[model samples]
Target chain A: MKLNRTNLEQRLDHLYDVIVVGGGAGGLSAGIYLQRFRLSSLIIDKGKARSSWMQSLHNYLGLPPDTSGRKLLQQGKKHYDSLAGDFLDGYVEEVTDAENIFEIQVKVGRQNSRNVKFYSKYLIVASGIIDHLLPLEDMQNVYDYAGYNLHVCMVCDGYEMTDKLCGFFAGSEASIEEMVFNLSWFTPKITIFTHGLFEVSGQMRSQLQEYGYRLVETPIQKFLGENHQMTGVELVNGSVIELETGLISMGARYHNTYLQELSLEMKGGNLVTDKLGRTSHPRIFAIGDLKVGLNQVVVAAGDGALAATQIWREIRKDIGPRKWLMNLKLPT
Target chain B: MKLNRTNLEQRLDHLYDVIVVGGGAGGLSAGIYLQRFRLSSLIIDKGKARSSWMQSLHNYLGLPPDTSGRKLLQQGKKHYDSLAGDFLDGYVEEVTDAENIFEIQVKVGRQNSRNVKFYSKYLIVASGIIDHLLPLEDMQNVYDYAGYNLHVCMVCDGYEMTDKLCGFFAGSEASIEEMVFNLSWFTPKITIFTHGLFEVSGQMRSQLQEYGYRLVETPIQKFLGENHQMTGVELVNGSVIELETGLISMGARYHNTYLQELSLEMKGGNLVTDKLGRTSHPRIFAIGDLKVGLNQVVVAAGDGALAATQIWREIRKDIGPRKWLMNLKLPT
Candidate 1:
């Protein structure tokens, strides 16, 4: 790649109408809308959207039922490409706020690198979260049916496990205590398996007893399943418990690394914003799993659209209604 | 009609998690995502979703690149129904915000009948805009090829008009002043066809000259086309300006009337929600077209998912994370 001069000072993209960081489904979706609104914007993604690794996506509408998460990310990126929306497959280092602009510093490469500074009028943080997956012996095997058989959000997949024997594996007591309760949404036949670690409270034990759920604290030998579906689990104590589904309630690591400096109100590890996708700072916005809400690919994509549109409206307001309206229609 | 007292609350056909106020693409998409999140929501429609009446959709991704807008809407509703989301063929009279609940009064039947209130905790105003259609001798013939040939959003359909002779039809000189300039995205070959309206000012005339666009202001109009493709417009001056495509920029009135009572930040004809789909009103939320920005079915669906998940996070926080986690299995 050639070290090129910046793309002109007055060329709009230099002083972007909108800047969307972390190009997951949410970021790309925002990019598509901004393009449609005829706004000069850019999406800077390090090619590390959390949704990229999801094995299966069961509930994204408009897509074929039971599609893969990786495929959805690809399609979202393709959609953004179609609009000719400017995007960089680079990581955003930091963002410094100003009157109505953001000074963004980006490191362009891993080996032979470059420094790029972008000035943006508005910012949308569509960066999704990082799932906390266990380092099991066969991780690739476990992820093959990750979204289908093994999942995170029970609300997104619990109803499908009706009347089926399910397993709740936990790394901590709080997770164990929580799993014992969340599984009651669909089925009653649940078995909580802890890897030789038990920190259950006396009150929790009585509650678990009242619910008639069996507890297995033995270390797991391996996951027993046919093909990719989890059928059961074998324990080190030489016990084989049959199961039809499994939920691993470990935890989540939201990719809010850049947001550490920018103080924003967060509830349950998510940035809080008003309904228009605006963050506490007017120019700064957040979407997808990074915010305090649902963690679905479709949801992130929608947040992308909302934040982008909000940015569009604000940007137009600056250009004045007459200029904004005159430039609203695409010439042909 | 019998009112079942014992199971009275459960014996309702219009009970919903969030009663969306429109039945267009946005409402349909929102309904689908809400159901996917397993929220019992209903879409109250006035049958005027601009996209629903269109014959095709070109900008929406994932379809065959040339899907009909009506077919897309049908598929959207079908997707929602598949997931068990409800719909009502009613017109909403008013929406009252009560603490954390919304009492939406809707007109279901003919005169001399009792109106019903759809009580929902959350409200997604996917209720889209009502496009002002020109009432000519044959109004039906004009809207036949709306999504296919005669479009609304320039971003959604501009690229399709590449290298094609397109016309921008406006009702007033003010509209002509605003729309003609914004249509610069599709192609440079454009002409402003004013259907006998106000005279253009010198400033407006200069802008048109600077952009090298031709302008026409005349009366009478027969929208002529063959095989559902607009061929041209026959002017009242007995002149026919041959063209391949056109978009009627009369105007869009986003009916967020249901949201008027909620004391939220309203901007540019939309309810401003934060990055996580939270409105200024703590208990209220808004998404889709009513929330502003790029109005599309996929975008609305995404909004629906975000709103639900945001609520889920708040619900999880209020009810505690253990509420979702409380029902799962206990360690054995």
Candidate 2:
């Protein structure tokens, strides 16, 4: 059943076998596997996953290269719902472990939101990192081509920018020093745009100069584009520079604040997980961008399945056979 | 291009960025990623992947619960072909590491087959394991329902056999003891069928007797069923034993014969791999059942992606950019 505030309260009477903290590819995959294992699961989604804004998924296997991330999520949601897995369009405020269960505090609706608590025997954190886009007054201007030609991941879209006039927009000199070297693999005609956010050091400036990459320190007034395809950028002092594509290397905003209280084992900004996607906390699993692994949609989906299988193995060993299978229907 | 014996010689002239062995889910997934990454690759398939016999992928995420493994493989092949990935239906004979590249010897056909040699900068061993089925004169009878109700994976189909009169067809007493105890979680009414393969130890017999399970020692048999649904078994002496389902506890044949000369690290039957699916040899990667991980379709697909990305990273660092992307097409 689709979970809403109305039915959520009543459903909380019984503890769920697993509570997935995101509705993105990873969480949905986990929910699908858990439900197939005859274990009850709930997936709470706040909406707009990192990949949702992606213009296309070029490397996902079995999918058309131009298939949009939004379409993939839509299809995944349909698959999850067909299994009768419970899904909610709400934000998870916090998850606190008590005794052997996790008490999740969730908030439903944006306006005059009501808080609800649900219990689960295990938790899967699939909440991924949010990319920091160009900080412009009209953020919609950035969104116009953010996921289009203006890409964030060089590992994903670098090949698409081969031999093109590429612009590198970074927030710091360190970002410029690092990203320019990486982007050099795609195109040598790179122009680093600091947008006057930070001062470029001599050492980094010489490194960029040695690489024959142009550096622009002008404060950008606005991005000039047509039909969601960015054409160029106009400086605050009235100079416009034309470019074929752009790479945004500002930084990332990891959505792991709710998990801060647990103080789980962390590597940089990600939670360290074993091969099976299990975290330091035995009952808590970290998958997708939340875990220290490749942040690909297919990898995230696989992580979910591994986590669900591990959880099933644990529960099965504890309860033994016949207990869970009695509740499942035989496949025809 | 679809690789057949006709174009195999001309293709061998070019050094493939990656040569993937076995055209199962893992190999195909790696092929898709390698082609998308702008790396030239070839997938050599011997045909009839183990999963090809799976009646239905009941637990695979995003697919319909009743989708057959053959159908999934067909779709994956179509997806790979659409990307212009080369696929050859042939068996690999041997792989010998040269100075920097690996030379692979392949046998193209069964009757009047010719030997072909191909060079690859990297190798991915995705040749999965083959299961041992009942060796009977009417083995075709077992094949009719091998992957249907006559399940091999308990974790995958245990729930489907819940509360049913399941039969355990094991080759060894040790296998019988282990599998029956594990299958007990699904149904307690399990009968062991020895088929006169080996002598059952007294200790193991007592253990089965204490579990309130039946034991049957038979010599000759043919499976009885209609439309691939197994109903019962016919013994050599014309005795019919009825059963709702059956579990084949035979062993598996790992397909890593080509790499036996490499002296690569091994843990029991599986090759140990790092998080990115890289084997002990930096240039070689093991995925699917050949690697030490969960043997599921989704996991194999994910492993292929991970291995391809890692290869890309290594190549990217070694040669930097433009060298490879120049061989790639820009996303339109």
Candidate 3:
């Protein structure tokens, strides 16, 4: 059931078994399982899933190597909708843990929006993080090649950049550690670009010299690329360095502001979760990039199934088996 | 590379980065990841994956509700082949763990089989379990509806049995506990059939009577059904008990016999694995039903990705980054 502002008002009184906070692979998978388990779930999505930006997902199992992450999410969303799961294209503003149920305040639209409250017995926080891109003066230069040739995750796109003239764009000194790992696994022709964000230590400079990797501390003027394929970069000093591919090791901002009121267990910017994706609060589960696990689509989808199954077990135990038939309809 | 008896001898000299013991969802997924990471892997399978018997998988994300498990395996196998992962249709007999690499002995054919040896740096034991069906005069009768109207896992098929005249077949007295859980989640109109295997206690009988459930302590003659849909069961005492659906709560035989040589930690029938599916032995891993986790296809697939990533990280750290270009070919 796709809920809009018109139909959302009538469904407000109904308490869902679980409320999923994103419509990415994880949230959609959880909703499909919950509906199959004979439980109601409402997915409130802000439509900013990081996977939507992925042009191609080469590693997801049972999918083609050329399949895009957006296509996978579209199929998952259709599967959830087929199971009659409630879906709303609204942003969750805040979540307050009431005694028995959690109260969710959602902003319905981007402009001329109205606040609405929803209730659910359990909550699944699948709102994933957004990666911080290179802070170039013209940000459009970065977007042209961000998902195509300029990759973010090394584990995902390292093979794509094998043996190429690669550019390792670092956000901080600590990100240089990941560059070393990438150099070992992918290509050795990597030039570390600081983008003038932070100063390189003396010891780090010596290590770079020992490895024979060039260090560029100048700020970038713009990326010189055509048709989403990054070819080279021009520095502020009007010097051009030709490259084949690039990796952005910049940090990301975790999208968990709605859960600020609930002081759940945290590990840095991620939520610490059990094997079943349960947080410090028993009723709340954090999965996908928000939790301390690999930010892969398949891993997040699996986390969703485990969390939904645990919630179903808890709910089934609380409410004992049905004793009477009572005009029961056959499960479709 | 699909290895048969002919090509199997030629590839015996090469050492793979990982050797997966089963070609199920877990092993296939692991093989796919290992190949994408530029690590060689070979999946030696016995071709008796438990998921092959699953008629349809309703919970796997992004797949249609009616997608058969065999279809999923086919797609996964194709994906793995596209990445040029080695695959063999053989049963692993034993694994001898040496200090550096593990030596594996395999039987290629079932009847006129030939012994073969393979070596790998890491091992993933994905040989899943096989459910024990009811022992009857005619075993084909049980197979007719085992994966159809009759089900095995309560978590997977409880919704399918909702509001139906369900026949709960128990293999042991402990299986009755699972029946109670099923009743709470599914249908209350359940009849417990002990198959004259064990004696029912007085307290248990009293509890069944109090809850208005029938206790049938009779040996079943045969199942009555048509077109793979079970209708009823005829007892040996010339009595017929009608049923709309059935659930077999019998136990399963874990297929981890090949790992018996290694003294790896085990919790009952499953291997004690870390969150990354790593066993007590650092080089060995366990996934799917062989490990202590949810027995779901998506969960097993996710476990494979995590285990393969960990192995890639270890190998990358051990072998430092390449120092020279050396006519490197682009990764396909």
Among these predicted structures, which one has the highest TM-score?
3
Clashes (N, CA, C under 3 Å) per candidate: 48, 3, 1
What tier of docking accuracy does candidate 3 attain? Answer: acceptable
Which is superior by TM-score, 2 or 3?
A: 3
Fnat of each candidate:
0.22, 0.31, 0.51
CAPRI grade, predicted model 2:
acceptable
lDDT of 1 at B152: 70
Give the local distance difference test score of model 2. 0.84
Worst 10 residues of 1 chain B by lDDT: B1-10
What is the Å distance of residue B63 in model 1 from its true position?
3.9
DockQ of predictions, in order shown: 0.21, 0.32, 0.46
List the lowest-lDDT window of 10 residues for candidate 2 chain B: B321-330
Best by DockQ: 3
Taking candidate 1, what TM-score does its chain B reach relative to the real chain B? 0.84
TM-score ranking, high to low? 3, 2, 1
Q: Which 10-residue window of candidate 1 chain A scores lowest in summed lDDT?
A: A1-10
Write candidate 1's Cα lDDT for B21-81 as tens digits. Answer: 7766656656665665445777777675767665655445444445676776776666777
Which is better, 1 or 2, measured by lDDT?
Answer: 2
Ranking by DockQ: 3, 2, 1
